[model samples]
Target: MNDHVEKMKLNTKKFASIGIMGLLGLVVIFGSVYTVEEGHIGIVKRFNEAKSQVNPGLHFKVPFVDSVESIEVRTRKNEEKMSSSTKEQMPVTVHVSVNWTVDKSSALDLFRQYGGLTQFEQRILDPRFRSATKDVIPRFEAEQLIQDRATSIQLIENNLIEEMKSFPVVVDNIQIENIILPPKYIQSIETKQTEKNLAAAEEHKLERQRLEALREVNTADAKAQGIVKVAEAEANAIRLKGEAEAAAIAAKAKALKDNPLIVTLTEAQNWNGQLPQTVLGESGMPILDLRNKQN
Candidate 1:
């Protein structure tokens, strides 16, 4: 009975030890396991020094010795209102937006240098963006800054990108939102624009009238040409008719010249086949002849 009781006691202690060991193992595993969410990068450090970086997923590390810091590698946005002077020494107020992200490849390096994302932005990004805006805004006149806003924004974005190339941050976008100018300058610009519009409208009107006048002149010239052509055609017809009548008269004269007996024949035909009732001598006295004939 004593031996069986001792065996039961030993088995109970063994099982209890095994259960305790399992629970400890579970605790260690749970503590070391970490899930890095999407758009975040994890830096693993052993003894407070960075050892390796893990991409977004489930990862495990040494429970107490290895530490992990997650840094967001996603794009972040910030806006700023900046005041600067243009090339002409006119003060301008501008609203700007900056989009940026921590380069994933340089995440560990960035963390080491800048400590955290918030620090990096507050200390480095903000100042550099402001500097870039100030530097680029002065290159253009105040009116150009307002009128050519796209160009101005591009210039600032390019400048900032170039300036930040040495850093571990990537500049995604820069937008110049609004520009405020002095009231007097704005009024002057408005006046000039109004005058320019009026001049353009007047020029367009004159050009339209000029084209209309040219069309009228062309129409008049066409009508005159048609009239001249008609007159020339009528004159040619009259000349041809006159020439035909003249030719007929000439032909008749030639026929008369060729045969003078035509006139005697014509005269005989007109005699109506009748002799004169009385024959008169040359002295205008009547003459009578008596003859007897047998037939």
Candidate 2:
């Protein structure tokens, strides 16, 4: 009975050891196999040194001896606000956005150099972006920055791209979202614009008044010309009527001079059919007394 009890205790100890080993083996297998999701790349690091890079899907590494770091290889966006100055030394605030992506081929090298994405952005990308923005912004005046915002943004993007050429990341695009100017300057510009508009309006009003005055002058001239024409027409008509009357009088005078008996004929034609009561001669005596003969 004592030997059988000792044998049963030994078997129990073996079973426990086997179970523990199996659990450890299971843990190792699960730990060694890792899946890299879509749009991500895995970097295998052995003893804290970057060894290799793996693409998306299941990948194997030595358990407890090697570690995998997954990094997103897809496009990303980051926005930053920077305080800068214009060429005229006007202080301004700029909001900028950047679209960037990690190079999948350079993942291991990037990890070896910068450790991870967070460190990469903090140490390299952020500083470079700030530097590029500050460097390019001072080349433009405040008014130019506001009026030609697209040109200024393009310049900034170019400078940033040039600055980032040596880095492991790809800079897809850069956008300048907003440029904030001083309130007093903005107010002054608005006031100046208002004054300019008012001056233009005043000039337009003066031009309109001048045109109206010119039009009135033209109308007066035309009316005066019409009146002068009417007076000329009336004078011509009067002159023609006087000429006609003078011609008729002259023609009558000529006819009367051509024949002296015209007056007698005219008197005979006008005389009534009646004899005179008395006729007086040069001696003032009655030459013929028709009244006595009739009696």
Candidate 3:
């Protein structure tokens, strides 16, 4: 009995030691670790289930049952070009970028909901981008797409966000890095623009000419009116002066008619002064000497 008890005690002690060793090995295996990488966030999963979200630091999880998933928290970029969207059926190469991140506040929920971030991009971001570009660009002709690409980009962004609404992802912005139109197409557009500008300029010139003609007509009317008024004033002045002169002459004639004695003496003086020369009819011959005859 004593030997059996001692054997039992020894076995129990070895078992306890092994159990402790096993527990320690588990902690080492599942313990938290720090990453040297920047711009990354961590997610913890327990038994294939998301348990917690962690920042960029040392973290631990339940040994074998827990796992850490790292996601890039920083902005990442990729370039894409859609050729069928340019004007003139010309191929347009656009360098586009997608800015994205795992929604940190929803990280645990997201991981659990979507299983991982990788699925989010494949299921949400890429399709959103592709569908948005395809759906919106078709509304525009190739020329409008390339020529008015900024407006097109905005439309694409709005549509992309609308499409991603039911998704677990968020798009910060849809960037259009470059727009390449065929050289011929660009030249054609430029020519059209120049023609439009010329038309506008011609319209302005015509408007100015019309205004100037109107002004000239007004000026001519004004000058004619001025001349007419001046002529009428001069006519009135001359008539008034003539009336005054005629009144003066009538007064003088009346005075002379009333002074008959003075008129007769003057007639006698005039007859004596002029009758002899006409009657003699000398070498200075006169056909009539009417003053002497009247006297």
Candidate 4:
């Protein structure tokens, strides 16, 4: 009985030693090393205080004394929707998107100042972005907000970037997703544009009528001028013909005055078998007595 009791006591001691060794092995295995993933940074903490930063890969730490906290340095995206008023007192809703990442060089300071990436974004970047949208949207009119949307977006982005200059967050891009205006305002704009188009059309019609009237007047004047030219030509032709006839009569009278015998010859050539009772000369005296018949 004494020997069996001693054997049981020795076996209990051996099992206790094995259990202690296993616990120590687990502690050494788990606490000695850490891994940093791709695109991540490991901040090593010794005794609850930050000591150093490690890049992606396998790294060793003091067993049971050191701890590592990882922060993603990869780019991240966040979106916000803002409501604002334009310069014209028009209400608008704007949707905005932001792409950002932790500045690698400023990561330690960032983690030290703020607890983590979430705290920095919540406390700094998001508020500034919202503030920038509110401030910039009011500077432009509603029409400008829609027509020059790209410009407005750029302005907002620039304001956001400037606001974040003192922070460690790197703002990669800011984009305007949508801008919605009131339906009544859109209808009013369309009505005004329609009125303007109608007025322009009326003005164009008047211009066309005026041009047509001018063309008619020009055509009438041209026809009148043609008629006047034809009448003048006819009058000139009549005057020339009268002048030619008068010249011929004058020439014949001069020839008759130069030779009276030509008239006697003309009379003899025209006489028939019957003779006239009297024949008068150029002096109004009887030249031939035909009262007595010639047997």
Candidate 5:
């Protein structure tokens, strides 16, 4: 009897322990709070009224008194409409993208008003974006809009930056990927561009040819100038040399005229005093008779 009673007591204790554990599990699952992770914002709500937000890390709230809502604070994306701009009946499509991230500083305040970051997109973001796009895009013709994609995107970004400052959304970038024009317009643009390109190429080729011709003419002129300079130097040198030679000859003639030996020899040759192929010497010089020619 004692052993049976002891076994019953042990089983009861075990069942009680399991029931307590089950109750604790249910309380933890239903009543406790959890943290929203990094890159996430937690929105707190009480009786469907938004209270505040928490950024990352662990946080706690009253058990079963408040509920937590989580939302991504990172950038989001969507495919936007690219409606035609002007009444010119020109239909063009522009593929654009937007990059936006939640503002960490304003997360708590944003969550109180918006409930979650995604709510910002539905209530605040979409409305502002549509209004801004309608105002800005229709201001230009389709042709003008296609050409200035960057400018248009900039205007949209500025508008977003101004309006989204109140919310947690921060605009990082806005881009236009492509401009899709009507087939007829596309064909016209392509043809015009081709003609312009051809004209540019021909102009470039002609300029190159002209430059080459000019270079050749310049080279020929330089060579001709070099040859003329060399020829002039040679002519000057020859003229100076000729003048020097003439001066030398005049000096030699003057020296010979001043000598007595040349004059005496001329007189002796002209003498009617006879000259012979062979003559006898009188003193130390040869003497000839003048009357020998009459014999």
Candidate 6:
């Protein structure tokens, strides 16, 4: 019975050792494996110190001595609403948006220097963005900022890119979404624009009236010229008719002086053979005078 009890206890110890070894082996296998999701990079650290970096895939490390951290390598956005002043000391609120991404090649260095993504943004990006914005905002006036918003945004972006040159970040783009100015200033601008439009319209009306008056004067001058031309034509016609009538009368008088017998011959040819019924003289006779006279 004693021998059987000792054998049973030995088997129990072996079973317990096997179970514990199996449990430890399972823990080691599970702990050695890690997966880095797509668009992320993994950093392996040993004893709180960064040792190596890995890409997105299944990777293995020392079971209990090493750990991995995954950082996002995708594009990210940070938007900030900041109050700043223009060149003329006008207070304005600007909404700025920055599109950025991590430089994958420098991911390890980034982690080493800044610890993590959050720390990098807080320590480097946010402060630099604010500084760049403040520096650029004061260079433009309120009216300039409103009228030339694209130039202002470009200046800000350039400042920011220069500021982040030494950091491990890629600034894809920067946008100035909105600029809020004073209410009174906006109202004054609108009123000025309205007045300018009214002035332009009035000027257009005056120009139209001037053109209309000029056209009427031209028409009156044309009509006057036409009347003068018609009067001159009528006078010319009357002169020509009088000259023609005078020419015909002179021709008839010349013919009569040139030949006196023409009239007697024409009269004898027209006379019929007849005698007078009564005479005024004592002797009953008819007298004829056929002579041409000139004055």
What TM-score would every model get versus the actual structure?
A: 0.76, 0.65, 0.56, 0.63, 0.73, 0.67
Give the per-residue lDDT of model 3 (tens digit) for 1-295. Answer: 9999999999999999999999898777757444424566677777766777788766656666777787775665544667555333446666676676556667677777666767867766776687777666657776666567788789888887788776555678777777676788779889999999999999999999999999999999999999999999999999999999999999878977999776778788778563354363567675555453553
Pitting candidate 1 against candidate 5, the one with the higher TM-score is 1
Task: List where candidate 6 sits over 4 angstroms from the true fold.
Answer: 1-13, 197-295
Question: Model 2, 40: alpha-carbon shift in Å?
Answer: 1.6
TM-score, cand. 1 = 0.76
Q: What's the TM for model 4?
A: 0.63
- Ten contiguous residues minimizing lDDT sum, candidate 1: 284-293
User: Which candidate number maximizes TM-score?
Assistant: 1
lDDT of 1 by residue, 112-163 (tens): 8887788888998889899999989999998788789888889889989998
* Candidate rank order under lDDT: 6, 2, 1, 4, 5, 3
Give, for candidate 3, the lowest lDDT window spanning 10 residues. 272-281
The local lDDT score (0 to 100) that residue 104 gets in candidate 4 is: 76
For model 4, the superposed segments whose C-alpha errors exceed 4 Å read: 189-295
Q: Which has the greatest lDDT? A: 6
lDDT of each: 0.90, 0.90, 0.73, 0.87, 0.76, 0.91
For candidate 2, the lDDT comes to 0.90
Better of 2 and 6 by TM-score: 6
Over 4 Å off, model 3? 1-41, 46-49, 55-67, 72-78, 85-93, 98-101, 113-119, 201-215, 232-295
Question: Ranking by TM-score, best first?
Answer: 1, 5, 6, 2, 4, 3
* lDDT preference between candidates 1 and 4, better one: 1
Report the error of model 3 at residue 205, Å: 4.3
Q: Model 2: per-residue lDDT, tens digit, 1-295?
A: 9999999999999999999999999999998899999999988889988899999998888999998889899998888998989999999999998999998899888998889999999999988888888888899998888888788778878888898899888999888889899999999889988999999999999999999999999999999999999999999999999999999999988999999799889988988977677678888775766665553
How would you encode candidate 4's per-residue C-alpha lDDT over 71-98 as one tens digit per residue? 8899998899889999989988989888
